[model samples]
Target: MQNSPKKEFRNDEALLDIQDRPTFFHWLILSIQHLFTMFGATVLVPLLIGINPSIALFSSGVGTLTYILCTKAKIPAYLGSSFAFVTTMQALMKADGYPAVAQGAISAGLVYVVVSLVISRFGSNWVDRVLPPVVVGPIIIVIGLSLATTAASDAMLNNNHYDLKYFAVAIFTLLITIIFNLYLKGFPSMIPVLLGIICGYLLAVMVGIVDLQSVAAAKWFSLPAFDVMFVNYHFKWYPAAIIGMAPIAFVTMTEHMGHIMVLNKLTKRNFFKDPGLHRTLFGDGLSSVIAGFVGGPPTTSYGENIGVLAMTKVHSVWVLGGAALFAIIFSFVGKISALIHSIPTPVIGGISFLLFGMIASNGLRILVDNHVNYELKRNLVITSVILVIGIGGAYLQLGHFQLTSIALATVFGIILNLILPQKARSEK
Candidate 1:
């Protein structure tokens, strides 16, 4: 249960370690910073998928708390709505409504739980063998690239017609986000997406595109819409929806590993060995299960909040817990939810432009970081097939079940990786 020795900070020392308790004032400020860091991306998922943003906020708060408790308050990580499931959720919502989406998400969570149990009994080595960088990197790429058309459509079109005004707003927002990300310093630099949205909203307001009626009519305090599972809708399992969604758990699990590695480097604690991957995965799975039941998207560990930890050098779990509390509090404020809902399509599209591209880039980064040799025919063939199938919109349908896009690509990539022959040392 003990972690490895802490690595010494080379430059400025960490202001707060994982176990360090910050004073009330410092804790509040630090916690609020983490909240802001996660807010933009967290809410964006539910917004795009036509769900109540407030519920997403509430679910994320609860999910983070669950993760913290499950990890023994040792790892300072925040869970938020995952982007990996966005396109799948959107399609499911369109085809079978939110109930199908909820069932799919719950099924995905169960997949995580089962995998965690197996890892607890055996080990995580099988994870790498089944989902090596060669397979995983392209799957991640497909997730982002497959969403490209959606981002573009939202950015440039209004009701299926290309609108110059909407396109202009999208471009402006994209520029603002890029500038803030590249040139800003310290805390402000960490929240380029939030800043970009705020600026975009103001521009929309000026152009008379944003309607204020909903925000004005919203109450100051109210409960988020919990129209999920057995709340407002009957629970029904769709095999098609489960097939489309459950495999995504594997992709996000790899992402979870990456985030854990990043935190280990930044905080100098061996979380994988201490709290253990099994515990973290279980927490994430349980959180998503709760989110599905309560009407929200699947949750995963956020890299944005991790950036805050690396920047401020504050790794206190208490600070993250406080942030979770803030998110929960924000969700009940009716005006806030209304305001988030009022965000124009162009603004969301603009943010997605950058965010989705960054996701694809991270996929490339995995390949680069792992040094997956493209010179090998096996590597080339796997990568090429995944890209073509994923981006070309190839799918398999049987009766009521269907597999398409990222999910299909992921399955193909894994099978290919398992069967492909490895190059010998002499081949080099």
Candidate 2:
């Protein structure tokens, strides 16, 4: 009986060891590679939602640092704005202007603060119970499929025959990316998305599908975009902002819980109770709030980055610390943005097709991994409504205000999931 306290003490010490783990060069290298992997996704959100790419870069850089501090530098998670918020942000910007909407989103960030507090005070298990794999899984799938439509539009951003040519480019790059990721060996294999991007650009340039003039015109040390904050602020669209950004709190919150759950599974420390979901939520919310202030989209703890951490087998928080430094360093440089933007639309178009689809697949994977069977009528209806609203319906407009299909779909998903009846939990 006297040994009980000693045993608990040893376990506590070991947990501390995991949190205070040291870093080495290999960890740094791994972190750098991971950074590159997320670069596209990182910039994609700001670009998609009309936020300045350069400002997005800066915000993401700072936001990452904020995330680390908030989580006490535990877990190798990287923070970036999510594309899920794209439609809502764009709509808010277009209709209500930017000020009121910005306030509304800032208010929405406060929602995250509340959520963080709840998770901290009670337990994260409640969040998990409310949004089980069954609910979140299909929603992820819808997000991916829904964005595919936008990818098609972007295929046009750099080319007119976007439908025909980009469809081909997208298919080719996607298959290449999948093959490399699944079968390729070694470090080169680790960045299949990057490889697909390189190949896609080459193919596009060779066929004259991509314009090369921008590459030369792009200055080596041009000033990064950090201005234009007040203009967006003055544009009051509070109603639209509230309606549009509020619901996304649900998406980001659910995603955050899932990442925290993953860290718990990986660290085997049950962080859901220790540093706790509340701490993690504050980190995530604070990170996004910072991103918004700097004219960037809201950030979230990335599940993909978690996969990278698992693969690297190096959980040194310092790895992310290095990555944060790297992002910050790049944020101030203008040439980086020009180079990324100049990479040819066909290349981005192709990569977007793959990355976006993978995002959707992850959502689908969530449902499958958790064994959320949909043979029952209730499950079927919940999924059907989410898909139609997310994937089938077009944008809706009321006078000056417009509600995007994606945002609408998300709202629809949350409602249906909450209301849907539960079938008996099957065997794991």
- Best by TM-score, which number? 1
Q: What is the C-alpha lDDT of each candidate?
A: 0.80, 0.63
RMSD of each: 5.4, 6.7
Candidate 2 overall lDDT versus native? 0.63
Query: For model 2, how does the per-residue alpha-carbon lDDT over 1-428 read when each residue is reduced to its tens digit?
Result: 01123333133422122334333544455556556656767888766666677677677778788877877775567887676566667767676554544555565577788888876667667655555656566666665677676666656554454356665666677677668777876545545655776777677676666656775676666555553456534543456577667666765665566556555544445666666778777877777666666567777766556655443334556666667777777666656555555555545556566656656766676677678777776678777777777778565565434455655665566677777566634511
Local distance difference test, candidate 1: 0.80
lDDT, candidate 1, at 314: 70
After TM-score superposition, what is the CA distance of residue 124 in candidate 1 from its true location, in Å?
Answer: 1.2
Over 1-428, each residue of candidate 1 has an lDDT whose tens digit, in order, gives: 12224546322355567877767776676777677657767888998999888999999999999999989998999999998788889988899988888888898898989988988999766655877878877876776677788779879998899999899999999899889878887656545666887899899899888879999999999988797677686556698788888877876776677567657656666676777889999999999999999999999998666655654567778889999998999899888767766788888788778766765666787789789998898899899999999989887664334465666777788898998779746565
Counting clashing residue pairs in each candidate, in order, gives 0, 4
Report residue 91 deviation for candidate 1 (angstroms).
Answer: 11
The estimated TM-scores of all candidates read: 0.74, 0.71
Score residue 419 of candidate 1 by CA lDDT: 84
